[model samples]
Target: MTTTQSSISSTSPTPTVPSGSGRVANIVLDSFTEAGRHVRIIPRNIEVLIFATIQPVMFVLLFSFVFGGSIQVPGYPDYDQYLMPGIFAQTVVFGSVFTSVGLAEDLSKGLIDRLRSLPIVQSSVLIGRTLSDLVRNIITFIAMLAVAFVLGFRFEGSLTSAAAATALLLLFSYGLSWVQALIGLSVGSVEAANSAGFLWMFPMTFVSSAFIDTRNLQYAWLRTVADVNPFTQVTNAARALYNGTDPGDAVMWSLVWSIGLVVVFAAIATRKFKTSSE
Candidate 1:
């Protein structure tokens, strides 16, 4: 018996893994695995992201080339400079519908719930979706930037300012993406998500100081609302960042609003993520 025990112990394989304290390590690994899956699946559906770019380009070309020749912005001799930033904001803002539709589809298909059942971090699913949306936004933004450059849009800011502007624009996009994700989770179908996302654009972008300056808005209430609109704030910040027009409150306000939006929508998304039967 003693000889047998010694031989068994000697022949035993060396322990390959250290004893973990608990399931935390497994959970984290699973979380990242799930996130990777989400990313992979999203980009595969290139059709959805391709759709996000169509409207942005249409608006840019129609407004910039057509109306831009006639309409002029004060202080900025070239209309392109004044229009480009607002155009970027408009494009990014409206592009958020993809997130809504994607989320709604995932929920309706029981994909999100299946993910939840896995031994992974709860927030991983949302994080993955948000990250995937960010990737789509980056692609769309790059496409728009390239088109704008071809159309003679130029930036007056230093390289640092350009970088900051890009980051800020993406942050705003991310925040809006989260909000849309929440909307998607609540909606009945992807079609509803798509329509509802665009429904807000008329009021949010048109009513704001997008196409015209707040000072020129004749209606007192509309002017006030435009001046205070977060879309306006984001556009102004992008304008300032692009034109190198001194760092000011617009940038600060834009950041504040973006952060606030992410916080609020993220909370709601998390709850829905936890409770979703889908």
Candidate 2:
């Protein structure tokens, strides 16, 4: 009995995490590690990459060729150039649904439970997933850009301005990822999460200046909504920047909208993550 007691006592106690900076560092490190895991999984799930690439490519092709001739932009020489930026913006925004479906799958498979069993931070899983999705979005952007190039879409602006526009789109997509993360955590299944994720995006993208000029919308309310829609702001900003037109206040508003979304949705997602974990 004494030997048994000694043996039990001698066994190492469960490690205790240090408070303050150390804890924060651990969370950051764990987030990167989780992000790496997600990146690695992409190769095995090639269908995700394929499906993500196909829709945007098709959009770029169909809109540039079939619809380009009929679409009239008052100042643009070629409608294809004007259409590409909106297509890119729409693609990134739609890409965010991948985050929702991925998170829902993880939750359904009890991956969250398994991760929770470890010493990692609770929010790291969501952060990592979003980060990975951002990387994936970058890939999708490249593919779409290639397709756009083939369809006669050329950047009229300096390379620096073009890069800035790309960055803004990615930032906006990252913000939307957090919103999708919240949806994923809230929904019971992947299918439900996918549906819930795109339910708002359809209206959000269609009602904006993505395909048609906001001023052309027949409905007064739609024009008003499109004027204020963040997606419209981003799309318009991207179009101006890429086409070398004066962006006016569109860039500023796009930045504000993206930052606002990140702030709002990140908080909501973090809270939902904690609740779901418990």
Candidate 3:
């Protein structure tokens, strides 16, 4: 056991601080190294990769065909136009869950203990994990986009607007990846992380304007909840951009919310990662 632990601990080389002058560069380098390691493992674990790609595609098909015609959302008679962005928002949000599950799995396998013994930047492990998940999300997004286009979902907005919308959604999901980082570190096992990470998102996504416009919601309280929901801002912003509609302040508010979540959750999760132990 001692020898095995030593081998795992040696996976990363000692990082030099040099009175912290090179700390930022060190973090970038180390984080990239860790990210590459995680991404490379994806192919070896092909089953998980397949499921990750399949889920969002399945969602697009189901919502675009099944629930789409029955539900009438004003200003979106085509339905696919409005629904695609919401589904994109939801897909990226769900993609962030991999962070928690990945971190928890590493912890259970004693990888965290091994990383703690290394001299790398303390935050590199989490950053690298999240970055790798972002790459996965990008791939999933591309796959979903192809399917959406086939279903008559055109980018009604200019190319620039479409790109900006995609970037905003990715940024939002990346921010939530930090939140999941804390969840993964706080939980006892991968199963706990998986359950805890996903339990709240149903209400988070469903209660918002992701599926239906806030105006169409029958209940006042539900509409209020949807209005206050940050996810609503994100979905609306992306939806407006994709549809080439005047977003007003939705884009700005979404950017602020996304950046805020990233800054706040990254700090909290990094702090937790430092003191966490089995």
lDDT of each: 0.79, 0.90, 0.90
Q: Residue by residue across 1-278, what tens digits does model 1's lDDT show?
A: 34554565466787556344557766456556655775676567778667767778788888877878777667778877878888888887776777788788887898877877665678767766777677767788998899889988877889789778878878888899889988888889989998887798778887776666778788899899998999988888888888888758988998999999899999998898787655
Estimate, for each residue in 205-253, the C-alpha lDDT of model 2 and write its tens digit. Answer: 9899888888888989989999999999999989998988899999999
Off by over 4 Å in 3: 1-21
Model 3, 140-255: lDDT tens digits are: 89988998998899989898999999999999999999999999999999999999999888999999988887888899999999998989999998899899998889999899
- Candidate 2 accuracy as TM-score: 0.92
Error of 2 at 40 (Å): 0.9
Off by over 4 Å in 1: 1-35, 41-43
Q: Estimate each model's TM-score.
A: 0.85, 0.92, 0.91
Steric clashes per prediction: 0, 0, 0
Off by over 4 Å in 2: 1-21
lDDT of 3 at 30: 80
Model 3: residue 145 alpha-carbon error in angstroms: 0.6
